[model samples]
Target: MFALISLSDLENDFINPYDLTQRLNRFVALEYATQVVLVAVLLLGGKWFLAGLQAAMLVYLLHSWHVKQHTVDATDVFRQLPVQKKRRLIMFGSFLLFFVIITYRFIESIIHGLLTEEGRAHAKKLFQDAAASVHGY
Candidate 1:
């Protein structure tokens, strides 16, 4: 099958010798390489996106603050705001999506780092101890 051949190719390229230590070392090396690539992309590709988001949020906050300062009542500014349900939903959804993406990335990094045999063993022991305490086993 094609999948088997692809797996064989990857094995030959990256894990041919079936040595755990070598594989772990290789994984760490690749992780460093990926970190470099991610830093480069964040610097080059993410800069503009971050800047635009910062500007938009800053402008909105400043406008709200100015309105509050000018008004005598604290809740006056909020009362004057228009209820654009569609825009509010879009912003809320986008924020939730961003949070989910960040959380997923964090979990992925943790799982990937703990994929090595030693790391897995440590994680297993930690979880087992926690489970034992919870179950009073």
Candidate 2:
């Protein structure tokens, strides 16, 4: 959520809403809002603890992006290129592929590292402490 908010703010004047990053951000936000609404309505609707936060988020998402009209251009020139030309977009600097793959591998390694036995034990201990604090233990 911070990432979405930050990118949207940073790219406030982004020329194309149809841009892949923007589209992905929107899709991710939509999925999140959907999950929040579903969880709030189905699970926490009657709870007094966190229901208000959940409901407020639903209201916020609905009031903000839902009511706004964000249109993607159907006649975008970028979309009119031949399939082969489109495939060669980053070919001028083949390093782009290497960068993407390396970045993906680095992130994957970090994710895997966080799931290692020691990492999981530490995370579980932290979560248990959080739960205890929340419950006033």
Candidate 3:
């Protein structure tokens, strides 16, 4: 999602209010769905550290979104900000911490995958295929 936003930013596609709002809404929905799945998995796995991290992330997301929504509803302070800037502010403010946990989980999964024999075989096959393609094989 951050990558999507970054690409959109690069393309300067959030200039339109409707597009920005739509993207933000989609982001919000994705965030909620992701958190729900993470929380459920953590609960089922009984991993203390990850469960705690997910809990903290969920709380932060809820609180930040709530506050931002209220702030936007209550005042004109953000009126001068561009739609893209506002989107960035809301997104980063809400999910930056969550991203840290996400990165940690991603790295952990990659390491775990590399540790398995099947995973190593799959990776080797992928690299071999890439090499074959590069060599026009």
Candidate 4:
């Protein structure tokens, strides 16, 4: 029984598609990180403002959509499989979803930062500079 179990474990490692899927799954987290940093740059009481935030969000959403669609396309191939296979699919899907959610919350933190009194005070100078540039005065 021990030998049989050991063989099974080896077989799993050798045959599991997760080895490939995990490599691809890494890209999902990478996308989330990229989006978070861009959001921070746009909203973290620095140089950018609402316009930059919007642009960053748009770009991130587009990239996320593309990756999600690709995942869906790949998932369709296994749609007819059994529960066990479906469970594995769900696990990977949730991993990507969780990272994306975490990234969004990070962006929300930046929004909170901007809404605070101190952050608003910082924004005032930025707005004044924008006004001066716009009016060329």
Candidate 5:
């Protein structure tokens, strides 16, 4: 819901309502598709919590970049409103903090995973499979 709201704000500048709706729908579809792929990757990697956090952070970062581009192209009136500016800054700051925390957690998880016996076995199998494939080529 929040994602849709942010996407709508980013797309609000379109002059045609039909075009705006189409673009929003496209974005929503694309986001869903990307998330499905991320979920598949997470499942394969077996780091559900950390990988999911990273995926969410990546999505937020992409959405923020999209919104920032639209805001940059906005008129001075849109850009200078103190209320809007404050709201945007607060939201961006909060998200940035979350992003940092998630990233730290992700790195920590990677190191922890590598230190575990099961993780080492998985890594060894992966490497062996890769080597076998290379030899086959």
Candidate 6:
């Protein structure tokens, strides 16, 4: 994984048609990347920014459909793959899917936890100030 990311030729790395087909790997990678970005923005409290990013990603994917048929091409990728590579691609894709989902959930929990904690602290402080004022402190 480290070596994969460190590779200078990211396009070449992602285009592997053997163990991990470019279609499956590329699609998963792009989705995972977008999800991570979304969660990161959510953690940073950039709700509006994340929404805009989502809209942009949607538009980009939609616009690119005319140039390339990813779904049909994915079938070709599968058909051309050797048996062993097909098995590996299936296992790798399943694992990648699980990892992406788990990571997103974990990030979501962290963001929710942070926001709830902050809200509680803010309410507590507000209450303390109100009580102090009432008591002329």
lDDT values for all models: 0.48, 0.49, 0.63, 0.52, 0.58, 0.51
- lDDT per residue, candidate 1, 61-94, as tens digits? 3554465421212223223222222333444554
Which order, best to worst by lDDT?
A: 3, 5, 4, 6, 2, 1
TM-score of each: 0.39, 0.31, 0.47, 0.31, 0.41, 0.29
Name the top lDDT candidate.
3
Q: Write the per-residue lDDT of candidate 5 for residues 9-102, one digit (tens) a residue.
A: 6447524444433543455456546656765787688967756665765566467557763232234434433434454465456557756976
Q: Kindly report which residue pairs in candidate 2 clash with one another.
A: none
* lDDT tens digits by residue: candidate 2, 6-125: 334434544453453454345546645664765466454464434554455455445544644122232442343332132224222333544575588679987897789998888789
Clashes of 1: 0
Candidate 5 residues lying further than 4 Å off, grouped into runs, are 1-80
Candidate 4 lDDT trough over 10 residues, lowest sum: 72-81
Give lDDT for model 2.
0.49
Q: Report RMSD for candidate 1.
A: 25.2
Those runs of model 4 whose alpha carbons end farther than 4 Å from true positions after fitting are 1-88, 131-137
Best by TM-score: 3
**Cα TM-score of candidate 5:** 0.41
Cα TM-score of candidate 3? 0.47
What are the runs in model 3 whose C-alpha is more than 4 Å off? 1-14, 68-137
Candidate 6 residues lying further than 4 Å off, grouped into runs, are 1-81, 118-137
The TM-score obtained by model 2 is: 0.31
Which lDDT tens digits does candidate 3 get at residues 19-110? Answer: 44444455666777788788889789886777786777677667766766412221232352355455456556546776787799899999
Q: What TM-score does structure 6 among the candidates reach?
A: 0.29
Question: What's the residue-level lDDT of 82 in candidate 4?
Answer: 42
**Where does candidate 2 have its weakest 10-residue lDDT segment?**
83-92
Root-mean-square deviation of each candidate, in angstroms? Answer: 25.2, 17.0, 6.7, 16.5, 10.1, 13.4
